[model samples]
Target: MSYRVSVTTIEKFRRYMTEASTFDTEESLLDSIKGFFLGNDKTKFGEAWGKIIEEGHKFKHVSGNLNGYLVDGIFFSEELARPAVEFAAAHPKMIYEVPVAKEYEVNGMTILVSGRTDGIEGNITRDTKCKFRTPDFQEYVDSYQWRFYLDMLNAKTFYYDVFEVQGFDSLVYDKKGIAWLHDINIIPYEPLYCSSYSDMHDDCKLLLRQFFEYIEEKNLYQFLKPYKSNA
Candidate 1:
């Protein structure tokens, strides 16, 4: 039986497993980790924000994407959507939410990776990353996205359109916890992900293999989400 998953889920599992200390308890971490396989994502704000931005490419900020979003109402959500919206407008040719998929053979196990690209303008693929703090460009260079997307598209250049958001107005923290603002792009790299392009296949295979073994050891197979084919 082949397994189907998204790069999103794969990375989520790896992150939670390796950074287990971040969660409050082992059970909490396990639940959180399992939630990924159960088709649950905890980053609602980020997800909604991304959706709102994509809405811009098509010139709309529908309600569901902004539900309970910003305190200033839909206006804030619209505000958050502005930068990328403007960028895409300027680029004018980029397509948002483009689907791409690939299959991999990991230790005789077939695993399929499938997902949508955030934006693709010509040969350059782009993804928007929203950050609460000032972003270090290096972080963008190190993400799994660019390489994965690059391989899927067979494009050499990738972009990380980054947006730096500010914290809410506050009294205690020395930082001006205030008013606010953030721009973005998917113009895209990373250290561990620094392996050469030719090594990408091997790197991905190893990751999927390790991921398979990790889940097997943790006995998480039962929680795996049902992809259309897998279902």
Candidate 2:
């Protein structure tokens, strides 16, 4: 049987499988894999801060939080997100939210990875992240998104538009948790200079091979479900 995968999906699988996050079971991770492949909301609602940061990219900031910033009906750090969106929008040539995709064959199984990027300018691609602390740049360095998107767009470089955020409590309790935003620009940790696209293909093929082996050995295929790609 074949599987549809995404760079994000592989990262999610790897994160849950290796990291010390709350979802610490094979069952939950399988469900997460299924959810991501099927575009279910499992990953979205799991945490609030990440979702808040993502939503913060949607629009420019308003002057004051007089009404209090609410996401999913709960107060969140809207101020922390303002600088990211503002700076992200400042690029005149950059187009936000571009779709990219490709298919691969790994160990006799079909794998399709697809997703939208944060922005692309000419041959340049950029992904934005808003964080409460200084980022471990290695995380971006080790990501699959840049390589995949770079090759898909046949782009020059992928940049991480990381923003640092710090919280400032409001005088009123309910209106608290507003934050200050600092923009940090990053060069590509792994620059695809020659653009062989072989490293990416080989890396993806290996990941799928290992992933499939795990599924087969653990008998978790039942959780993967059927996927029909939009292509």
Candidate 3:
């Protein structure tokens, strides 16, 4: 079966997937958005969320408690270290940072995307969630988070680290056995890529347009529904 994605969604997906940009404040976000809209920059919500979620996998707890924060710090540090270490581990010839840059194109409206990766070459591209069941890796298809980084760098495999956090005395059920496990779970994900950025962007834009149309239709229906009811 075929799926439909939009440029706006792809924009959002790419932002969501690319694993860089660690600004955790409202002001910085506002500044980034202003820059993107004004053409001063391109690191908007789409790309930011993509990368944010991607790195978020390393974090185990969605609850944001003390333990979670500890793990988060470790994860963030690891994310920073992954690129440098991976390069060092794989190729003794050269070392590089995770490529972080913006790509721009003029297709009627300006299209900008950020490229930040952990440089874990030959790894899977995936997102993490706080759920028991593993999510379908395909969910990141039009995700502005993953696609942006994957597209910008042309990565063949991606990973999602969905983590389930339990207390120190929680029991786990698995095919092997039912035993008490620690407070963290790790799930890795991989997605398939076929189209180019331009193609993905077109799909994202279409979805955004359709989303606006749906909102308008819903609002109109609500407005008319009351009138028809009175009649």
**Candidate 2: tens digits of C-alpha lDDT, residues 1-231:** 666666676666666666734644565676666673342222222223334434544433344654323444334344443443345346657776778877677676666677788767787787766444455677667666677777667665788766544342222223554333224222212222223255776776676677777778888777664455445
Residue 69 of model 2: what lDDT? Answer: 35
Quote the lDDT for 213 in model 2.
79
Instruction: Give the CA lDDT, 0 to 100, for residue 5 in model 3.
Output: 25
Return the top candidate by lDDT.
Answer: 1
Whole-model lDDT values for every prediction: 0.58, 0.56, 0.36
lDDT tens string, model 3, 1-231?
112222333343234334323422434333333333342111221222234333434343332332221121222233332432342344343212254433333232223333444334444433323334444445445355555555555554554443322232233345544222344333333324433454654554554444335334545223211111111
Worst 10 residues of 2 by lDDT: 184-193
lDDT of 1 by residue, 1-231 (tens): 576767766655555556623543446546644663342222433555566555543334344555222321222445555665566566677788899988777766666777788877887777776665556666555456666677766777776766665652221222433222223222212212222388776776777788788778889767765434432
Superposed model 2: Cα runs more than 4 Å off: 16-28, 36-82, 168-198, 225-231
TM-score against truth, every candidate: 0.68, 0.64, 0.35
